[model samples]
Target: MSKIIKKIFISTIMVSTTFSLLMGAESIEISPSIDKKIFHEQYVSVTVKLNNKNISKVLIVTDKNEHYPIELTTQCDNVCSKIIKLRLGENSIRVEGYIGEELAYEVKNELYCASQAFREYKEAPIKYKERFFHTDKNEKLCAECHDMSNNEQKKVAFVDVKDSNCFVCHKAITLDRYAHAPSANWLCTSCHTGEIENKSKNIIEKSKFIAPKQIASACFSCHDKNKQSWDTKKHKHFPVEAGMCTRCHNPHSSDNKMFLRVNSSFLCLECHADKKLSQQIRGNSKCPGEQKDGCTECHNPHASDYRFLLKSPHVDKKIDNNIKGK
Candidate 1:
């Protein structure tokens, strides 16, 4: 009986040793991401997809053994993923996998991130689809589109992708389906030259285009023919008063009436706060009783163009106090 017990113990030890030797980091794969710029971005998304189901636990170990557990989801049968955020510059990530707390495999890789937006090389532009035939063929402006006898522009033969150059061929934005009054009348200098030319934008370098504006006054330059300022309105939509014209209206032209980015009903409810209350407040309009059709059923979006923009008779006009009013 004692000999039998000793034999069984010896067999168990042999099996455990064999299993350890057979266990390899073969099936495990660690995908690495290349260095990327994160200019004006919150975080550099460094995703490392690990493929191996045997790994039950994963960790992203950075410098100083700072272990961050990787939260993974199954993409397919044998794939796991987690996005890791790293600061700018050299990052050393050590990925380790475990089978129920026992370290099974490990992978080491180096990655770099940058917060600057400078590129040493860029792909040459071969696809210039914007070179469509111009409708107006009175080509008197030579310097506008072409390099006049090599005045030493960056590209001698090719027209650089500049808005000033674009106007030479694409001057017909004003003739759009629903052209803006300023654009249709060829009044480019008002908005583009005075406002846009001075503004800084994504390039962070000096350029001709104006920086995009957020203040309402920029759009009010032409949109409100009455020259009525949002500040002076008795009742103003939050976005309109805030000068977010681009929120609802398309910048150029649209097939939709009034150049709306989307249908009015859907656009209004996006920020109206309460959907059920909005339906009650809007009341039944000429619309065919589709409650989901939203706030534009009766209310004129820009202002109280629809009978003083008052609350619907269906809605109990109440103030912030939440008390019902007539």
Candidate 2:
């Protein structure tokens, strides 16, 4: 009888230990799945389906290294859900479920805030997509952030109701860079007018300056044609004449001087690569040749009165020989 009682006690202990281990081992299923590439909204609704019932707490970590606790509606039944706001660029998120003070399980997901960026190469960065505007995918919230009414005219100010404005989310774009005049002055309506009426900001894959005429209208609207040297100069850069300013200059902001797409001399070399003139220009005695500040030393970027867009009419024999490869 004593042996039988000892055997029963041991069996009960084994079953209890197994049950405890099963309860401690936790896992989760996230809705919308983890594979979703981009979320266009400033706020994303996430639903987490849990496998364990004892998970009493939840924590969320953002890409910016922000940590916050989200209250779960149901601990066991139904789905645990939370609305999360995302920052610009890539967002790496970690969702951790906890029981008491101990971490039960953790999972990670990645998302992107779709906004317009430079489209120099064949594709934009994997984390970012080239989009026309920054409106919410749902709710069509243009009025929440932008100047929808024509009363604002050229100036776009933040709406007083909910702290909504362009800079609220997109301040990173111009950080540590020289912003364009119109961009710096909150003159978004100057260029972003038309077709934005009551529409969502989901205009991805559409190039902002798709047409040369549109580009000309947006640029020359602020830069008066009468003051420009293009008309006065005999020789003109084809991009300038064609009203394709974006080919050479970034419309928003740039680290490079004069909002150039790249450093001055290298920018000139990008197009001149086909001519095999990079080496000749670099070694030429008549040229300044410093990568950062050379091309503009002798050549006028937009146009010039002299041939070869030379800054001055007096051209050197060496320069002429370098150009002709004599």
* Most accurate candidate by TM-score: 2
**Per-model TM-score on C-alpha atoms:** 0.37, 0.53
Predicted candidate 1 versus true structure: per-residue lDDT over 9-84, tens digit per residue? 9999988864663355454555322222221111223334445566787787876576778666543344444445
C-alpha lDDT of all candidate models, in order: 0.47, 0.60
Across 218-237, the per-residue lDDT of candidate 2 in tens digits comes to 78866776337588788888
* Model 2, residue 135: C-alpha shift (Å): 6.4
Write down the worst ten-residue block by lDDT for model 2: 115-124
Which candidate ranks first by lDDT, i.e. highest? 2
Q: Which ten residues in a row have the lowest lDDT in candidate 1?
A: 127-136
Judge candidate 1 at residue 309 and give its lDDT: 54
